[model samples]
Target: MLARLTIFVLILMLLAIGWKAWAYRKSALSALRKVEVISERFTRTDFFEEDNRRWIDSGERPDVVFMGASITSRWNPEGKLGDLAVAQRGVGGQWPSHYLLRFRSDVVDLHPRAVVFKACAITFRPGVNDKGTRRAILDLTAEAEEAGIKPVLATCVPVREDGNTVYGSDGKKLPDGINDRMLPFNDWLRTLAAERGYPVIDFYRAMADDRGFLPADLAVDDIHPNDRGYEVMTATAKPILETLLGAGRG
Candidate 1:
C-alpha cells in the first residue's frame, strides 16, 4: 500500500512540474510574439545589407551606423552624433537578444565601418529572460566580429525605478535587484570592452544627477529619455563619435 502511495505521489509531482513548465513557455511565447509585432512596425528589414542602398550603390559608404532601441531611433543622429553619414535603427522595448537576431540584417549588412551600440536603461530592469544582458552583449560582439565589423558598446542609462517589478499581484514589490545588478553589469561591460579592445562609452555615470538617480526631466517617462536627456547624450557622445569618424578604418 505504501509503495503504491509513493508511486502516486511521484507521478503527481512530475505532472505538476510539467504543467508549470508549459505555462512558463506559453507566457514567454506570448511576450516574444508581441515583440515581433512591434518590430515589424519599427525595424528596418534591409538595415544591414541593403540599408542606405541608394547611398551605398552610389559608392557612398556611411561613416557609422547606430543600433539599439528607442534611444537610438529617437535621438537626432545629425544633431547628436554630428553631420557624418549615419543610419539610425532603434526599436523601443528591445533586449540584447532581439538586437543579436537582427544584427546581421540591420547592422552587418549595412557595411558600416563601425557600429555603435546604445543600451537602453529599460534592459537593465527585470521581466527580460534568458541569460540576461551579459549573454546578449557577448553574443552580439561575437557576431559582429565574425562579420568583421567593430562594435562600440555603451553603458545602460539610469532609470527612476528603484528596482524591478514583482511578479504576480499582491501589490507587493519583490526584490527586483535592478540597480544592484545594473552597476555590476556596466562595470563588466567596460572591462569586457577593454579586454576585447573595443571602445566603451560610459553614459551611466554621465547621466546621473546629484542624487545618483536619473533626473525626472531627462526622462518624461521613468525609462525613456526626453529631448533634454537626448541632448545630453548627444553632447556627451559628440567627441567620441567624431573621433571615431576621423580615425577611419584599420
Candidate 2:
C-alpha cells in the first residue's frame, strides 16, 4: 500500500512540472509573436536582407559594418562613424537571434573588415532567456571568425521604465529586478570577449545615469538612444574604430 501511494505522488509531481513548463513556453511565444517590427515579414524569409543589399552591392566594400537591432538600424553611419564606406543593418524589434539568422547573408556577404555588434534589451524580455541570448551571440562570434571578419561585441544601452512605454504596449512596468537579471549576461559577454581577444564596447556605462536609467537628454524612449545619446556613442566609438581601420588586415 505504501509503494502504491509513493507511485501516485511521483505521478502528480511529474504532471505539475509538465504543466509549468508548458505555461512558460506559451507565454514566451506570445511575447515574441507580438513584437511590432518594421519588417512586416521578419519571420517569413530573408525579408530584412533587402534593406542593406544595395549598399553591400555598391562598388565600394565597406571598412566596417554595425550589425544590430534598433540602436544599429537608427544610426547615421557616415555621421556617426565617419566619411568612410561603413554599412549598417539594424531592424527595430529584432533580438540578437534574429540578427544571427541573417548574419551570413547581410553581414558576412558584405565582406567588411569587422562588425560592430550590439546586444538588444529585447533579449531580456519575457520568454527569451539569457542562455538563448548568449548562445545566439556565441554563434555570431564563431561565424564572424570563420568569415575572417573581426567581431566587436557591445553591451546594451541603458534601460528604464521612467521615460516611455518601450517595455509593453499597455505601458506596464518591467519586472522589479529585470536589470539585475541582465547583469549576469553582460558580465558573461565581457568575459567572453576578453578570453577571445575581441573588443567589448561598454555602451551601458557610457549611457546609464547614476541610478542606471537613461537620462532624458540621451534617450527618446526607455529603450532607444536619442540624438544626444547617439552623439555620445559616436564619440565613444570613433577612436576605437579609427584604430581598427588603421590596422586593417596586415
Candidate 3:
C-alpha cells in the first residue's frame, strides 16, 4: 500500500510537469504569431483599394495626392490647402517599397496634377533596408514624372526626445543613432529634389527645435505630429505647393 501510494504521487508530479511544458509552448507560439502579423504588414498593398475605387467612381480628380506612411496618414490636407482639391492616400506602418507597390493605383490612377511623397521616419530605424528605401523613392519619382504628375518630396519629420530615449510607432525605444541618420537622409532628399528639379517641403526645418529635435509642443510622439505640428507642416508646405502647381500651368 505504501509503494502504490508513492507511485501515484510520482504520476501526478509527471502530469503536472507535462501540462506546464505544453502551456509554455502554447504561449510562445502565440507570441510568434503576433510577430508574423507585423512582418507581413509591408505586403498589405491592398490597404487603400476600396478608397481608391471610391475616388475613381466619383469621377473627380484631385489636384494633389499626399502619399506616405503614418505621418501622412494623419495629415488632413483637404480644404486646408487653399482651393485645391486634395486626396490623402497615406497608409500607416508602410515602407517606401510598399509605397511603390500602390503608387500607380493610388497616385497615378487618381490622375492628380501633383503628388507629395513623404517617407515614414520608421524607415530610418536601425536594421531596416535604407538602400531599398532610396530606390523605391527614386522609382516613385520617375513613375510620377512619366505619368505627368509633378512629384514633391518632403523631408521626414524629426523625432522627439522622450526622457532618456526616443520611442517609435511600435512602442519600442529607438537608438539615438536614428537621429544621426535622419539628418543625412533629409539632406539627401533635398539634393534629389534639386537634381530632379521639383519642389521639396522642408518639414524638418519647419518643426525642429534649435537642437534639431522636434519640440514637445509640435510632437504627438517620437515621430508623429500633433495638430500644432501639422499646422506648422501645412504652413511650410503651402508656399512650396502653390509655387509648384502654379509653375505647371505657367
Candidate 4:
C-alpha cells in the first residue's frame, strides 16, 4: 500500500510539470506571433510595389512627388496645386527610417523634379529627440540632391488637444505628449531647411489654432487633417510648390 501511494504521488507530479511546460510554450508562441505582426506591419518595404510598377509602366514622370506618412497619403495635390504633375507616395503608420529605406525606390526612381518630405507628428512623439530624425532627413535630402532631385521639407501638422491617445498598428495605445514636440520639431525643420537651402511648406502655421493645437473643425482626429484642414494645407503649399517648380524649369 505504501509503494502504491508513492507511485500515485509521482504520477501527479509528472502531470503537473507537463501542464506547466505546455502553458509556457503556449505563452511564448502568443508573444512571438504579436512580434511577427508588428514586424510585418512596420517593415513593409513593398507597400508601393504595385503602384510604382504601374507608374513606371505608364511612362509618366511626375513634376513633384509628395512622400511622407498618412497625412501626405490623404493629401490630394493633383488639381489643387496648379498644373504641375504630382505623384503621391505616402505610406501610413510608417517612421522616418521606413521612408529612408524606400527612398530610392519611391522618390528617386520616380525621378521627379522635386520631392516633399513631411514626416508625421507621430515620428517625433514624447521622449524622442530630433537627432536621429534630423539625420534621416539629411540623408534623404543628400540622396535626392545626388540624384539631381530637389528636396522640399514640410512642417508636420499639429495634433488636436483632445486627440492625444494614438494607437499602434498592433492595437496598442501609443505614448501621449505628441503635441509637446510638434512645434519644436517644426522649428528644427525650418532651420534645417534654411541651412540646406531647401524650401519649407509651413503646414503647422496654417493648421494650428491659437493654442497651438489643431482646431476641431480642421482635424480628422488628433493627428490628421480633415478636408477643411487639408484645404488650408493645400493653400499653404501651393505657392511653395509653384516656386519650386518654376525655379526647377529655370
Candidate 3 lDDT over 37-63, as tens digits, reads 765565565677898898899988888
User: Per-model C-alpha lDDT, please?
Assistant: 0.72, 0.76, 0.83, 0.83
Question: Candidate 4: minimum summed lDDT over ten consecutive residues — where?
Answer: 121-130
- Candidate 2 residues lying further than 4 Å off, grouped into runs, are 1-40, 44-52, 161-177, 247-250
Global lDDT of model 3: 0.83
| Candidate 2 C-alpha error for residue 105, in Å | 1.4
Q: TM-score of model 4 relative to the true fold?
A: 0.77
Q: State the lDDT of candidate 4 residue by residue for 53-97, as single tens digits.
A: 877889877888898888988988688887878888888876676
Error of 1 at 189 (Å): 0.9
TM-score of each: 0.72, 0.74, 0.77, 0.77
User: Candidate 3: which stretches are off by over 4 Å?
Assistant: 1-41, 163-176, 247-250
lDDT of 2 by residue, 63-86 (tens): 788888778878875755655567
Candidate 1 accuracy as TM-score:
0.72
